[model samples]
Target: MMDRTDRHCRYFLRQISARTLLYTEMVTSQAILHGDLEKLLGFTPEESLIALQVGGDDPARLAKCATIAAEFGYDEINLNVGCPSQRVQSGNFGACLMMEPERVADCVAAMRSASNLPVTVKHRIGVDDHDHYEHLRQFVEIVAAAGCQRFTVHARKAWLKGLSPKENRDVPPLRYADVYRLKQEFPDLVIEINGGILTLDATLEHLAQVDAVMIGRAAYDNPYLLAEADRRIFREAVAVRSRHEIVEAMYPYID
Candidate 1:
C-alpha cells in the first residue's frame, strides 16, 4: 500500500465507503522527523478515521513521528513491519525487524509514550525461513507487551533474500490460518487479517475469525467493491451512492 494509498487515493476510497477506516501510505520516521512536515503528513478533514503508517526501527524518531501524527489529527499511528522491499530492509526496518522483536517493542513503546492516539503494528505472519506459528506468536506477544493492542497481520511470509517486493506478495503462500490461530491464542488482542482478501464475502468471512479484515491491492484496483462496504459491513441504514454519483462528487477535486 506504500505508493497506492496516498491522499488522493484515500479520498477516492472515502467517497466509496464512509465507514471503513483508511490508512495512509507508509511514511518513514526520518521523513517525518526531517522532511517538510505538511508535504509529508497533510490531509483534509474529510479523511477522518484515517491512520498514518510509519516505517522505522528507531524508537526516538518513531516517537517523534507518532507525536506529529497525533498533532496532525490522525486517528491512529501504525508501525509498518510488513513491507519486504529492499529499500525498507536497508533501513533495518520492515519485515526484517521481525527478527528483532525487542527493538520493535521499544519503538512501539516509545510511540505509545509520545502520543495518546492508539499505537498499532502491521506485520507479516513470518519472515523467510522462520515461517512458523510460534515465531509469529512470539513477535506479536513482544510487541503487544509494549502496549500495542492492535495488530494487522499480513497472512504471508516475506522472503527478504531472493524475491522482489511484488514477488514477495505473490510467491509467499498466504497462511491465513496462522493469523487466525494468533487470534485464538491472544484473545485479548485486536487481530486484523490482511492479504489476498478480495470480495466483500471473503472480508466478512475473515471477520468471523478475526476482529477485522484489511483489504489492500484489491481495494485499490477494483475500488468499486468498497461501495457496498458501509451497508454490508457497518450495517448503516444510509442509502448507498451510485458509482456515477461518487464520480460526480470527485469531479471538483479532479478539477
Candidate 2:
C-alpha cells in the first residue's frame, strides 16, 4: 500500500472491510523527527487495523517515529525498504537500503526497543544492477536477528538509477520464486509477497508457499475483491450482499 497511506485511500479501504488490515504510506524519519509530530502521527485510532510505514536509515530517528506511531495506537509499525522512487533513493532510503542490511537491522532493532507493537519491514528482493537471491537472504538474516520477524517483499529487483518509481514497479518483472525461496530458507519467519498480485486466486496461491500475500493495485482498482476476503481468506463467512446493496450503502459516505 504505497500511496494508499493517504486519508482518501485509507477511508476507501476501510469501507471495504472492517476486518482486513490497512497500512499507511511511507512517511520518512525526517518528517517525524523534524516536522510536525501531530500531523505525522495523527490518525483515527478506531478507523481500522492501521499500521504505520516509516522510511529512513537512521536508527534513532526510526525508533522515535515508532514510538510516536505506537503512541498513536497504530496496530503495527513497518519500515519501508521497497520503494524505488528517485526522490526516495536520493534521500538514501527505500530499495537502496537493501544493500546495507546491517543498517536495516540496526534500524529495526532500534524501533523494536521503542515500541511493544510488532515491528516489520517491507522491502524488495534486491536493488539496482545487483540482483541476487543471496543478497535478499543476507538481508533477511541480519534483520531477523534484530527481532524483526515479519517481512513483506515486493517480488522484484528495483532499478534505482534507470527507472522512474512507476517504471520501477512495472518494468522490472516480479519473481515470486525468489521470494518463495526465502520462505523455504527461513521457515520460522513470517514472509508476505507483494508486487504484481492482482486477484484473490493469485494471493491465495502464493499463500500456499508463504505466510501471506499483499495485494496493492488490484485491491485499490477493484475494491470488491476484498469484500470477500473476510470469508475466503479468514474463513469467516459474511452475509452475502448484492453489489447494488453495497453501492446504496456507500451513498451516505460518498459526499
Candidate 3:
C-alpha cells in the first residue's frame, strides 16, 4: 500500500465512503522529521478521522513524529511493524521491529506521551521462525501493556530474507485465526484484521469475529468496492454512488 495509498488515491476513495477510516500510506519517522513537512503530513479537514502511519525504531524521533501528527490533526498515529522490504529491515524498522517487542513498546509509550492522538501499531502476526501463536500473543501483550489499545494486525508472517516485498505479501499464508484468537483473549482491545479481505461479504465475515477489518490493496485496486461501505459497514443509509457520479464528483478536486 506504499505508492498505492497516496493523497490522490485516498481522495478518490474518500468519495466512495465518507465514513470509513481512511489511512495514509506508511511514511517513515525519518521522512516526517527531515523531509517536506506539508507533503508528508498535510491533508484537508475533509479527511478527518484519518490515521497517519509512521515507520521507525527510534523512540524519540517517533515521539516527535507523533507530536507533528497531532498538530496536523490526525485522529490517530499508527506505527508500522509490518513491511518486510529489505530497505525497511536495513533501517531497523518495519517487520523487523516485531522481533523486539520491548522496543516497540518503548516507541509506543514515547509517542503516546508526546501527543493526545491514539497510538496504534500495525504488525504482522509473526515473522520467520517466530511464526507461532504464543509468540504472537506474547508480542501483543508486551506492546499492549505499554498503552497501545488498538492494533491492525496483518494476518501473515513476514520472511525478511526469502521474498521480495510484493511476493512477501502474497506467498505467506494468512493465519487469520491467530488474529481472531488475539481478540478472544484480549477482548478489551480494538483488534482490526488486515490481509486478503477483498469483498464486503468477506469483510462482514471477519467482523463477526474481530472488532474491525482493514482492506488495503483490495480496496485500492478496485476502490468502488467501498462505494457501499458507508451503508454496509457503518449502517448509514446513504445511497451508493454510481461510477459516473463518482467521477463527476471528483472533477472539482482534480482541477
Per-residue lDDT of model 3, residues 18-46, tens digit only: 99898898999889988998898788877
Lowest lDDT block of 10, candidate 3: 40-49
Q: Model 2, poorest ten-residue lDDT window?
A: 39-48
- Per-residue lDDT over 1-255 for candidate 2, one digit per residue giving the tens place of the 0 to 100 score: 565567556765666666777887788899888888666667664456888888999999899888888778888998999888888888899889999999999999999999898999999989876788888899999999999989999998998887888898899998999999999999999999999998888878998999998888888788888887877888887764556766776676666
Q: Name the regions of candidate 3 deviating beyond 4 angstroms.
A: none
Q: Write the per-residue lDDT of candidate 1 for residues 85-152, one digit (tens) a residue.
A: 99999999999999999999999999999989999999998998887899999999999899999999
Give stretches of model 2 more than 4 Å off.
Answer: 240-255
- Compared with the true structure, model 1 gives a TM-score of 0.98
lDDT score of residue 67 within candidate 2:
86
Error of 3 at 197 (Å): 0.5
Better of 1 and 2 by lDDT: 1
Q: Give the candidate order by descending lDDT.
A: 3, 1, 2
Least well predicted 10-residue stretch by lDDT in candidate 1: 1-10
Task: Candidate 2: give the clashing pairs.
Answer: 5-25
